[model samples]
Target chain A: MDSAILLVRVLDFVGTFVFALSGAALGVERRLDLFGVLVLAFVTAVVGGIVRDVLIGAIPPASVASWHNLALAVAAGLLVFWFARAVARLSQPVLVFDAVGLGVFAVAGTQKALDHGIDWPMAAVLGMLSGIGGGMVRDGLTAQVPTVLRSEIYAVAALAGGLVVVAGGALGLPPVPVALAGIGLCVFLRLMSLVRGWRLPVARPPEP
Target chain B: MDSAILLVRVLDFVGTFVFALSGAALGVERRLDLFGVLVLAFVTAVVGGIVRDVLIGAIPPASVASWHNLALAVAAGLLVFWFARAVARLSQPVLVFDAVGLGVFAVAGTQKALDHGIDWPMAAVLGMLSGIGGGMVRDGLTAQVPTVLRSEIYAVAALAGGLVVVAGGALGLPPVPVALAGIGLCVFLRLMSLVRGWRLPVARPPEP
Candidate 1:
């Protein structure tokens, strides 16, 4: 049990780093200054968690109070800022890391919602929101359509993961196995969609 | 008094309608589809209040739970969508309404934060956030630099209003008069800036 918690914690940190890097990369692409890059990185890595925490009545969200998370996000931003040219070449690895982060956040978010006595349906939705909120905010800040809105895979994968967690919990499954299964489902679906180039159709105007 | 609450509510509704119209207009200018226009309008009209509600631990934000707010936002969006050319001609009225919304939100937000047992400093900050958060989100969704970051007047006006509310509350003044004073300060500042063409200087890179 302790080991499972430790594993999730380690993955959460790694995920935050990769997400922050992605945000910083966008900042560089947009020709933003150092402050802008750092702000983007911080929001991308932490805002999803903060949003989820706030929705579930978690006061003084961990993103605001936890120095470790803040430090990690800022460090990731600095690293990207200093080595942007080198980092941009590694987009493939970054996507994979983002998938991992999404999966971890989905499971963790659902768990937190459940712990707060939220029903499974709402918990599942919040879990998906937790996975996608940061990226949406990041893309929005840069004046782009969020990938989740245009792409089917990412949000669907997170929602699927959340569903698995809720179902497992309802069936009286242990926490460790349930979390692992949810994470596995989300990661697999996300990576698969990327490889397959799957996307949701954009809304179209009716033929006049 | 009951009359004061009623007056604030009426102003709130008016402010929401104008903000929603502004968002919908931006969507039309961006050449987005109907769905995009509605989404932008909804976010712009209600997100500030939603954000404030969440920070103060108000579960199920009234913005989301209240059918009236949602309907008003959606209705305003539809109005602009169907009459884009006409709405564009009324830019003068829109600015005036935006300023009013800023004032009302600033004072109301500060009051709500104080009601939630938050300290005066944080309450003031939250109040300002409530006034600007929706517009920031709207611009972000449309991929623009939030006006709050580049414009000198808007956020400053909101903060000034928040400060007035906090100070008044601290001094044991009555809520009704204090709110009116805060609102007056915000509206006056906003309109003055618009008339004078005031803007904050953008950050520049330091010389090497």
Candidate 2:
């Protein structure tokens, strides 16, 4: 049980780091000031968890309860700001990490929801939300329609990851393997979709 | 105490209705479908209170916990959709209602935070956030820059409203009158700024 908790915590930290990196990268692309970039990074990294926590009655969200989350966000933001070109050049690696982050957050959020006595259905939905919420906010702040609302594969990947966790729990399976499988499946789906250019059909703009 | 709670609840409902109306109006202007317009209205009405409730550890959030909030939002949205032209002609009334909504949300959010044992400084900030959050989300979802991020007087009005609540709490003043004063000040500031065309300086955009 302790090990499982530790695993979730570690994965959560990793997820925060990767999400913060994505947010900071976007901030740089948008030419935000350093303070704005850091704020965006912190918000992206934790907004999902914060939303989940608030829903499940977890006061003082985990990220807000600890210093580590902010530290990671600050580090990621500073790294992006100080090494803008280098970070930009690392797009491929960043994408991979971002996918991993999404997978972990989906699984972990579902797990937490279940632990907090939420039903599986809501837990799964919250899990998907936890995976996508940060990016949604980030895009909204940047005045872009959120990719999660448009992309076919992004939300599917997270929902699939959540389902794995829910199914495992219902089947009385061990936690660690279920989580690992969920993450793996999510990353696989997300990456393959990107490679194949999978996208939902977009609505045409009204005639101007 | 009971009456005070009732006052907050009543004002909160009124706030929800006005905010929802504004959101629905925006959606109609944007030519969104009926379902989209309703969604926007509901989101705009409740998001601010949801944020406040979550931060203050109010679980199931007042907006989410009560059916009345949703009902009010739906009612307001439908009214706008069915009477689009009429609603447009009522823009002056709508703006006044919107400002009133902002004022009540700021004061109520601050009062709740203080009740939850939050410090004055943070309570004031949260109050302003509660007032502005809904519009920010509404604008962001519609792919526009949020007015709260740009406008000087809007947030200031909300902050002052919050400060009034905090001051009342600190000075052991009666709740209802303090709340009334807060709301009145906020509405006055917001409306005056609009009438006078008051604006903060904007940074120049970089040459494309």
lDDT of 2 by residue, A56-175 (tens): 988867775445787899898888878777776664644665688789899999988888899899999899899999988887787777868666589889999999999998999998
* Candidate 1 local lDDT, B64-168, one digit each (tens): 434577678879888878877776666564466567778888888887788789999899899899888888887777668887877568999999998998998
Question: DockQ, per-model, please?
Answer: 0.12, 0.12
Error of 1 at A26 (Å): 8.1
**iRMSD in angstroms, per model:** 6.1, 6.1
Put down candidate 2 lDDT per residue, B62-124, tens digits, no spaces.
888779899889999999999998877875644665688899889988887777777676677
Error of 2 at B203 (Å): 12
Cα RMSD (angstroms) for every candidate in the order listed: 7.2, 6.8
What residue pairs clash in candidate 2, if any at all? none
Residue B22 lDDT, candidate 1, scale 0-100: 76
DockQ of model 1, rounded to 2 decimals:
0.12
lDDT of 1 by residue, A1-208 (tens): 4654564466567667878887888888789999999999989888888887777777688778779888998898899899988877875644665677788788877777777777676677677778878888888788778866443478778888989989988898887888889999998988887988755333332232
